[model samples]
Target chain A: MCSMKVVVCVKQIPDPAGNLRLDQASHNLVREGKLILDESDSYGVEMGLQLAEQAGGGEVTLVSMAPNSETSGLRTALAMGAANAILVSDPALGGTDALGTAKILAAAIKRAEPDLILAATESSDGYTGTVPVQVAELLGLPSVTFSKKVTVAGDKVIVERQTELGYDEVEVGLPALVTVTAGVVEPRYPSFKGIMAAKSKPVEELSVADLGLDTSEVGTAGSRQQVVSVVPAEARSAGEIVTDDGEGFQHILAYLERIKVI
Target chain B: MTLNVIWVVVDRTGDKVATVSLELLSKARQLATTVEAVTWGDPSQIAEVVGAHGAQTMHSVGDLGGGLPGPAVGAAIADQVRSGSSPDAIFIPQTYNGRDIAGRLSARLDRPVLTNIVDVEESGSGLITEHAIFGGTEVLRASFTAAGPGLFVIRAKSFAAEPGTDGAATTDNWNVPDLASTGAAKIISSHVEESEGPKLDEAPVVVSGGRGLGDAASYQLIENVAKLLKGAAGASRAIVDAGWVPYSHQVGQTGKTVKPTVYIACGISGATQHMVGMKNSKNIIAINKDQEAPIFSIADLGIVGDVKKVLPQLIEALEKRN
Candidate 1:
């Protein structure tokens, strides 16, 4: 059986470091600044590499859609052993949410006819794990989501789905999608040899037009959804710490009982 | 009359309804006597159940899974907007499925959707709903000025539903056709993972482990306690990143945000990601060998003791109570 072609859908977003920020007028994460590949997306990249390696001979392509600096994240993927990388960056592709991002990525996957699509279960800042499922929906591909472990048998992709309570064993036909969890595989550090080789690998930068995606169908315009506003959640008041000192503890217990904590 | 909107019950799966469906049914009856309910999946005889909940007549969409996301339950309500008799607000449990339904419905119906509301009260123009945000750090109230229906999603356990609320009408048949072609998406199949413990989102007691648990085997201490109490178990992203817990068990900014009544942290050093998840728990207990651990910042009870030693005692106490 031929090895499967895997595409890891990655997103470059604002670094979560100063995540709690208020823009002057918009009260949003100001976009005129630092952005990086979402950290969880690295797990998706790592899973793609592992799957490709286990299959003997195949390619793992890291694909992203955003402004041009998004390619930096692709380099991180390249460092991790992705066979090739692609960045769909253009002013037109800016501010795309999960649905819009998926539309662009689905188009990119169709170009290579990948057997499997991998993505992180969630983004660090946006915190919405909605993209992978939405993309699978658009591509009409079956999805085994929140997957902690993944395997392949012929053309079937088997995975263990991570859920709120436990895990499930599921197998879907190839040309499927999986949103990877941290349990899937530990991402490899950029080895010196891999870093040298990554330079030789292909990283073709493309614009929204190259994917045959109506750029209007991308970004805020393409998004059927929008975060109407972003505000730092209200601050928490300092709580009164209580000690279990007999009578003093009784007061604490009364307070706890009032809040029904005990 | 608080508009007493009675919602029809539909099973989440393609088959029979669940107990939570009845819970929603009872709550919907309490919401209003007008009883405009939307029932998806096996809508037959739902009106009978709806009628018993004080519904004037239940609104039902039949044989729903013709090919739709499970959240079509919300879209059906949106698409079947009625003649001056639609609900002023729509309420749903803030489940993963429920949130999606509320989001999609809010988008399609052009209403404001507020999630994780614990209660609703009468306000100046409409209703004010309360939500727990920034973990459990703050409680906030919001009211919509929009004229149409306001959408709300609450946890299933947030309100207790009493049965046989005398005036409930029988489950009525509502056939909503518009949901069939509203979106270009459909769920061919959905296989859920089998998890131990109570449904994490709805659980009252939750115990979490973190990187300090040291190894995967060490998680058994947390799991043992969870099993004894049949409560949910959680993990910090550090532990999830360290490979001790699956991402699904992760409680943090990038993972599931839960508000259990009692949440216990064992060996977890509270990171921002971790705090965002369990911050809303009514009570928090932290057991870390490190007295300097950040988990103590949010813990109502802090024990500067080894979790490996402390967990066994906690499990025994809970088991002894049983």
Candidate 2:
């Protein structure tokens, strides 16, 4: 693998489907004081770090799209093992849906000019599994996602892609974009040595305008998919457990028969 | 007036293919007055398959659908829409690769994507697509903007494969689509992994065990029942945390929300998280020693005896049936 530059896109979302407490009035997920790496994004982060480590010379820069106040996770990435970090934050970037998110990422990728860009296939919140593909479209670059294993040698990039029943092996040229699945690699726990090393890495902060993005082209205003409303699902009632082995066995069989599982 | 439905044919694994594309021919024979079925790759052979499916003609995007390569296929589809060959409704399989292509095409054309759909209904001039969210607990109703192009992803085994048995297959050579030049980012190597068994989301039966299974050996009853039923196996968060089962099979908010047709709970206390995963199942059967265990309320069938005892009898009955 060559020492090609790599950029990792990280998002700090509320834990996957955590009791997303909403403000009573605004109906926004109350996440001012809490955030973690979007569970799905871990795959992308781990993949990017693996690439850089394999190359042995180029660095992996952790870049995040979030409000300026929510930049700690990006720093945490630095603390983990990122060679450097950057925060692309601004009020204008708020409430960007997946497409808006992709547009923002495209601008960020262009600004970084990295040879490779990696991201999670989806954000657990949206579960659309569309951002990386959308980002590829917005950037007009060749991007294939759900890649399980990635190897780079010379000008070619080889990836093990997750398919419906099995996997397929495909090789493409360099400087492309890919989104990874969980099997990419296990993320390393940050040690004291890595945490201290991260402290010395440079972090560049950029606002929305600094990237030369058309603010109108990215954000809630640019998105077509709107969240009409999110209601808490009804609570399931306590279940019944029958103890009579004879009757219970019959009941279980009857239940399965009713559902046509038999 | 009826709307155009362009059914995108896919292979068994959900990957796009020419043979499966022809299956659309059988349905097209019914709806082709306004509906069109398109086979996206192999200009000559796929078009014949599409014709058999009832397409008056095929729309070919150069180097897509089969052996065309993933990224190129994606851009070619986008180029077709950009060139005004937009579909009123598009159908693709809900496989991993299919969704990636669907996601890309949706983004490139700036279309709203409703993914992993199970069924579609028409409402006046607009169409409604039904989607299952959070595994299956929530069913979302969506209608495309008036006469908007709708994308439908069909689950394998949900729709029966129809061959071109009823219609004569027609053939055409569609001119390849021209891809718009984009910034060139070189390709990388790719690999594929093969996964089998009933997928967690679509399995018909799921047998889940909890901490009451005692230890490793106690967990065997759950597996035996699952095997007898030809079903997927799952575990509660408690059992998973105890190292009784791999976390992949954990049924909870943090794990998988499965909508199997039948869910059998063994020794589970019915924690809220576990309930969230199996509550949407069509029929729930709970087996726990405690007669008042929380899992019984929602269960269609309740067995208050030990799962170890109950499961063997059930399996024996199944064996007798076979």
**Chain B TM-scores of the candidates:** 0.75, 0.61
* Per-candidate total of colliding backbone pairs: 27, 39
Best-performing candidate as measured by DockQ: 2
**Candidate 1 C-alpha lDDT tens digits along A1-262:** 3676999888777776554443545323455565666888888888887788787779898877767545666676788889887777788865565556666777777787898889886666555455565566556565656667788878776676543335556666677777776656778888988878877888777878888878776665654433333334554332444332223323323443566544
> Compared with the real two-chain complex, what DockQ does model 2 have?
0.34
Give the alpha carbon lDDT tens digit for every residue of A1-262 in model 2: 5576888888887764456454555333456756777655666776777777777767787777776557556656776677776677788766565666766677777777787889876665545566777777776666757676788867667776655444566565667787876435666677888777767778777877888877876665554443334444454555544567466688777767766778
Q: After superposition, how far is residue B225 of candidate 1 from its true place, in Å?
A: 5.1
The parts of candidate 1 lying over 4 Å away from their true place are A31-34, A162-171, A212-217, A220-262, B1-203, B223-232, B240-258, B289-294, B304-322
Considering chain A alone, report the TM-score of candidate 1 relative to the true chain A. 0.85
Best by TM-score: 2
- Model 1 Cα displacement at A214 (Å)? 4.6
Task: Please give, for residues B113-220, the per-residue lDDT of candidate 2 as tens digits.
Answer: 665454455567555666444434455555554244665554433333465533433433344444343223333322333324565655788888887677868787
Worst lDDT run of 10 residues, candidate 1 chain A, spans A243-252
- Off by more than 4 A, model 2: A21-30, A193-202, A227-239, A242-262, B1-33, B41-70, B116-125, B128-223, B232-261, B265-281, B286-322
